[model samples]
Target: MGRKVEEVVEVLVEPIANRNGLELVDIEYSKEGQDWILRVFIDKKEGVSLDDCQSVSRELSDILDKKDPIDKTYLLEVSSPGIDRPLKKDEDFIRFSGRKVDISTYAPINGEKKLNGELLGIDEGNIKLVVDGEELNIPREKVSQARLAVEF
Candidate 1:
């Protein structure tokens, strides 16, 4: 049910983002506390603004109200992905190469489930990361989640 809502929202929101010169980063639908929340992550090369979020929320709200896709009431949220934005696509890996990243795998690789390092970008079908003093190559298929990591 959640997955279906996400799919629908993604389809509904992508065009709206594009029309507004925003990149659709991701969409998430999940039960929070006792309510369902639908979050839409948006971005741009110049970064996003409060006005951008407000515009998207207002425009999308009208569309969702008309379409009435979800059976239950859900809160719609639109915002920027921020500095720790998730790396969800091949392009994201390329775009964020050389940045620090945290990667989590569905299964342990090299006896590790999580790795934090400098992203060396994707090669072939694997992701290369410079961890510690060594380089680690993890298959993209093995990655469960990945996001930009702040170095502090």
Candidate 2:
């Protein structure tokens, strides 16, 4: 049910984002307490602003209201992915190379399941990382999740 809502929202909002010179980073639909929240993450080369979020929210809200995609009432939130934005696509790896990232694999890599380091990008279907001053190659398929890591 939730997945369908996400899919519908994605299909509806992606064109709107592109038309506005924005990238639709992700969509999430979930229930928290008694509320269903639909979150849309957007991005641009120059980053997103409050006005950008409001614009997207307004435009998408109109479309959603017209299409009536979801049967349940949900709160719609549009925002930037922030500094710790997720790295989900191959292009994301290339675009964000040299940034710090947290990666987790389905199974142990070099006896470790989690690694935090600089993103070295993709190489021959492997994710390259520089952890603790040592380079490591992790197969892309082995990665279960990955996101930018804040180093402070």
Candidate 3:
């Protein structure tokens, strides 16, 4: 059910995104507390605009009504991924090259699950980071979740 909904949303959203020159960051359909929420996170090479969200929301709403994919009620939200955007794909690493990031793993990498360093981006299938003068190569598969790190 989850995958089916994601696929439908992906199909419905791509054309709208392409037409508007926006990048579809992710499609999420999940239970939030007691309510089901459908969240679409979008981006652009430069950034996303309010008008961009409006355009996508308007187009997607029409498709959802026509398809009636979900039987139960769900809140639909279309928005930008924001400053701490998720690092979801290898392309994201490439795009965000030289940005600082925070990543955790399923198991420790060099006895650490948490790493905060400059994102040198992906080299082959590994992510390169410099931590305390030591260069570390973490296999992509080991990453649990990663995002842009906030600097103070």
Instruction: Estimate TM-scores for all models.
Output: 0.95, 0.91, 0.91
lDDT of candidate 1 at residue 81, scale 0 to 100: 95
Better of 1 and 2 by TM-score: 1
Candidate 2 Cα outliers beyond 4 Å, as residue runs: none
Candidate 2, residue 32: CA error in Å?
1.1
**C-alpha RMSD values across all candidates:** 1.1, 1.5, 1.5
Candidate 3 residues lying further than 4 Å off, grouped into runs, are none
Residue-by-residue lDDT tens digits, candidate 1, 1-152: 98899899889889989999999999999999999999999999999999999999999999999999999988998999988999998899999999999999999987899999999899898998998979998999999999999767
Residue by residue across 51-72, what tens digits does model 2's lDDT show?
9999999999999999998999
Least accurate 10 contiguous residues by lDDT in model 1: 143-152
Candidate 1 accuracy as lDDT: 0.93
Clashes of each: 0, 0, 0
RMSD of 2: 1.5
Record all residue pairs in model 2 with backbone atoms less than 3 Å apart, i.e. clashing.
Answer: none
User: How much is the lDDT of residue 7 in candidate 3?
Assistant: 84
Kindly report which residue pairs in candidate 1 clash with one another.
none
